[model samples]
Target chain A: MLEHVVNGLVLGGTYALVAMGLTIQYGIARIMNLSFGDTIIAACFATYVLFSVFAINPILALLIVGPTGYVFNLLIYRFIMKPLVARAPDEGALEVDSILVTFGLLFVIQGVLLVMFGGGYTSYSFLNSPVSMLGTVVAGNRLVALVLSLTFGAVLVGVLYRTRWGMILRAVATAPQSAPLFGIDTNRAARTAFAVGGALAATGGGVVSMFQTFTATAGVVFTMKALIVVILGGKGSVPGAIVAGLLLGLVETFVAAYIDPGLTLAAVYTVFLVLLLVRPNGLFGKA
Target chain B: MTMKTSHAFLLAAAVLALLAAAPLLIPDYWTGVLLGMTGYVTLATAWAMFSGPTRYVSLATVAFFGVGAYTVAVLNETLPYPLVLLCAGGIGMVMALIVGFSTLRLAGVYFVIFTFGLAELVRQTVSWWEVNITYTMGRYVFLPFEGRHIYWQLLALAAATFLISWGIGRSRIGLALKALGDDETVAAHAGVDVTRIKLLLFVISSTIITLVGAIQAPRWTYIEPSIVFNPTVSFMTLIMALLGGAMRLWGPLVGAIPLFLLFEWLSVSFPDHFSIILGLLFILIVFVMPEGVLAKIETLRKGSPK
Candidate 1:
C-alpha cells in the first residue's frame, strides 16, 4: 500500500508536469494544443536515442531534448497557431479551431516519428538500482523523477505566481483585451508561454521514458492521460492540475494494483466521467 | 446564402448514381479503396452535420461506431442484420442522449474530453467482457454478400449520410445551430433550444455512424473491440471532415477522396510513414486553407483580399 502511494506520487508528478504544461498553454495562451502528447512522445523518443544509443545520461539528454521541443513548439505557434490566433475573432472560435489544428499536428508529428522510429518500443537504460524505502522498493529513476517533477512544478508555479513576468502573463491570460491597454506584448508573451510549456513537457517526457518503455503510437493514450489530468485538476489552475494529477496517479496506481489490469483504465475514466456530472470543474478546479 | 436543399439533393443524387456505378468504372484494386472512402465519407459528412453547426468538436467517433459493431458482435448470432442495425442505431441514440445530456452543459473542452474518454470506457468494457464472457479475442463474421455488394452498400450509406447532412444544412435547426455556434448565450436568449438541438443532432449523427459501422462490420472476417472501437478511425473521420471543410455539406466529401487515396497508398507502400505524410498534409491544409478546400475555393472565386 505504501509502495502504491510512492509509485502514485511518481506517476502523479509526471502527470502534473504534463498537465501543468497543458494548463499554461490553455489558461494563458487561450489555445489548447492536443499535440501535447505527441510532443512528450517526441521528447521521449529523442531521449531514448540519446541515452540508449549514444550512451548519454537521460538527465543530460534533457538539455538537448528540451530546447528542441521548445523550438519545435515555438515554430508550431508561429506557423500554425499565430495564423489561427489572428483568424479567429473570438475565444470560442479559437478553441474549436485550435483543437482541430492540434489534432492535425498530432497526426503529422506521429507520422514523422513513426517513419523515423518505425513505431517500435524504445527505452532509456537509466537508474537501474532500486532503493529500499519503508518496506517498499522504488526504482532509482522514479525517485529522480519525483524530485525533478516537484522541482519543476515548483519552478513553474513560482515563476507564474511570484514573479513580475508571471504578473504580465496572468494579465494577458485573464484579460487579453485589456492586456494591450496595459501595454503587455500579449502575442509575444503567449509565444513564450508556449515555449515554456514545451520545455516543461519535454522534461517530464524524458523523465517518464527513463522509467517506462514507449513508442510513437503511445501518443494518443498519453494525450488522453494528460487531458484527464488537466480536466481532473481544472483547466487553468497550476496547483489544481498538480493536485489532480497526483490524485489520478494514485487512483490509477491503486486500481492497477487492486484490480484486473484490463479493467483499470475503463474503471478510472468511467468514474471520472460520472464525477464530471457532479463537479464538472474537477476537484481542485476554481468551480 | 447558398444552394437550396432541393438543388443539393439533385446534385447529390447524380453523384450517388455515379458512385453506385463506380466499382465498374474504377480499376479493380481501387474498388477496395473506393469502398473505404465511402465509409469515411459517411462518417465525416455525418460528423460535420452535428459538430459543424454547433462548432462543438466531438472526439467520440468510436463511441457511436462501436455501438453498431458491438451490437452485431454480440447479437449477430441471435438477431437478423436488419434487427441488429435497428438495435445498433437505437443503442447509439441512447448512448448519445446519455453522453450529450451529461456533457452538453459543461464547457466545450469538457465535451471533447468526455467524448474521447467515452471510447476508452467502451473499449475497455468490451474487451473485458470479451475475455471473461465471450471467451474469445474476436468473433468470426460471415455476411452473405460479395465485395461489390458491400461496396455498393457502403456507397449507399455515404449517399444517405450526405442527403441527411444536406437537408440539415438548410433546415431551421441548422440555422439555429449555426447561431449557437456563433454565440451560445445569444442563441439561447434568442429562443433557440440549444441543448435539445445539440442532443438531437448528436443522436442523429451517431445513429448514421452506428448504421455505417454495422454495415461495414460484416465485411471483416473477424470482429473485435479493437477494430470496431478504433479511435484512429474516429479521429481520421473527424480530421477528414475538417480537412474538407465542415462549413459546407459537400466539404468532407471533397476532403475524403484525396485523404482516403493517400491513406490507402501510404498504408500500403510505406505503412509507417503515411500518417506522417497525412499529418503533413493536414498541417498544410490548415496553413494554406484553414477554412477547408471549399472555403479556399470560395475565397479564390470572390478574389477576396486578405
Candidate 2:
C-alpha cells in the first residue's frame, strides 16, 4: 500500500505538472491545444537524445528543452494560431477554429515524431537506483521526478498568485473583454500564457523521461489524461489540478493494484462521467 | 416540396441506381476501392446529419460502429444475417439513447471531450471483457460475403443515409436543431424542445452509423475491439464531412470521394509519410478552406470579377 502511494504520488505529480500547462493554455490563451501532448512527447524525445546520444544529464537537458518549447510555441502562436484568432468572429468561433487547427497540429507533430523516432517505445537509464522510504522502496529517478514536478508546481503557483505578471494573466483569464479597459494587453498575456504552458509541458516531459518509458505515438494517451485532469480540477484552478491529479493517480494505482489493471481506464471514465453529471462546470470552474 | 428540391432528389436517385450496378461493370480491384468509398460516404453523411445542424461534434461514431460490428461478430453463427443486422441496429439505438441523454446537456468543448471519453470507455470495457471473460482478444468473422455483396449493402446504406439526410433538412426538427446550433439559450427561450430534438437526431444518426459498421464488418475477416473501435474512424468521418461542407446536402459526398482517392494513393505511394501528409492536408484544409471546399467554390463563383 505504501509502495502504491509513493508510485501514485510520482505519477500524479507529473500529471499535475502537465495539466497545469494545458489549463494555462485553455484558460488564459483560450486555445484548446490538441497538440499539447505531442509537444510533451517531443520534449521527452529531446531529453532522450541528449542523455543517450550526447551524454548530457536529463536535468541539464531541461534548461535547453524548456526554453525551446517556449520559443517554439511562441512561433506557433505568431504564425499559425494568430491568423485564426484574427478571423474569428467571437469566442465560440475561436474555440472551434482553435480545436480544429490544433487537431491538425497534433497530427503534424505526431507524424514528424513517428518519422524521426520510429513507431517503437524508447527509454534510457537515468537515476534508476532504488531508494527506501517508509519501509517501501521507490526508484531514485521517480523521487527526483516528484521533487522536480512539485518544485515547478510551487514556482508556478507563486508566480501566478504573488507576481504582477500573474495578476495581469488572471485578470485576462477572468475577463478578456474587461481587461483591455484596465490597460492590460490581452494579446501579450495570451501569448505569454501559451508559451509558459509550453515550457511547463516540456519541463513535465523532462521529468517524466527520467522515470517513465514513452513512445512517439503515446502522446495521445497523455493528452487525454491531462485533459481529464484539467476538467476534473476545474478548468483554470491551479490548486484544483494538483489535488485532482494526485487523486486520479491514487485511484488508478489502487485500481491497478487491488482490482484489475485493465479497469483503470474504465474507472477514470466512470469518475469523469459522474463528475460531469454532478458538476458540469467542474469543481472550481465559474458558472 | 419545391420543384427544384424534388428534381434534385430524383437526380440523386438516378445516380445511386447507376452506382448500385457499378460492381457488375467494374473490375474486381475497382469494386474494392468503390466499396471503401461507399462505406465512408455512408459514415460521413450520417455524421453530418446531426453535427451539421447542431454543431455538436461527436467523436463517438466508432463507439456505435464498433458495437454494431461486435454485435454481428458475436451473433452471426447463431442468428440469421438479417436478424443479426436487426440486433445490431437495436443495440445501436439503445447505446445512442444512453449516450445522447447522458452527455448532450454539456455544451461546446465539454461535449466533444465527453463523447470522446465515452467512446474510449466503451473501447476499454470491451477490451477488458474480451481479455478476461472470453480469453480471446480477436474473433474471425466467417460470413458468406463476397466483396460485391458488402459493396452493394454499403451502397444501399449510402443511398438511405442521403435520403434521410435530405428529408431531415426540410423537416421542422432541422430548423430547431439549426436554432440550437446558432445559440442554445435563445433556442430554448424560443420554446424549442432542445433536448428532444437533439436526442432524436442523435439516435437517428448513430443508428445509421451503427448499421454502416454492421454492413461493412464482414469485409474484415477478423474483428477485435481495437480494430473495430479505432478512434481514427471518428476523426476521419468528422474531417470528411467538414471538408465537404457538412451543412450542404451534397457536401459530404463531394468531400468523401476525392479525399478517399487521395488517401488511397497516399497510403500506397508514401506509406511511411502517409500520416505526415494527412496531417498537412488537415492543416491546409482548415487554413485555406475552413468552410470546406464546396463553400470556398461557392464564394469564388459569387465573388468573381464582373
Best by DockQ: 2
lDDT of residue B262 for candidate 2: 86
- For each candidate, the DockQ is 0.61, 0.64
DockQ of 2: 0.64
Q: Show model 1 residue runs off by greater than 4 Å.
A: B1-30, B304-306
Minimum summed lDDT over a 10-residue window in model 1 chain B is located at: B271-280
Tens-place lDDT per residue, model 1, B1-306, is 387857866886887788788788788777877778888888999898888877788889878887787787777888887787788888988888888888887777878877766786788888888798768888877768666777887787777777687678678987898899788999999999998898899889988888888777777868888778876787778778887898887788888888888777778898766666766776677667767888888779899676
Q: For residue B257, give model 1's deviation from the true position in Å.
A: 3.1
lDDT of 2 by residue, B121-184 (tens): 7878988998999898888888999999999998888888888887887788778877888899
| TM accuracy, model 2 | 0.97
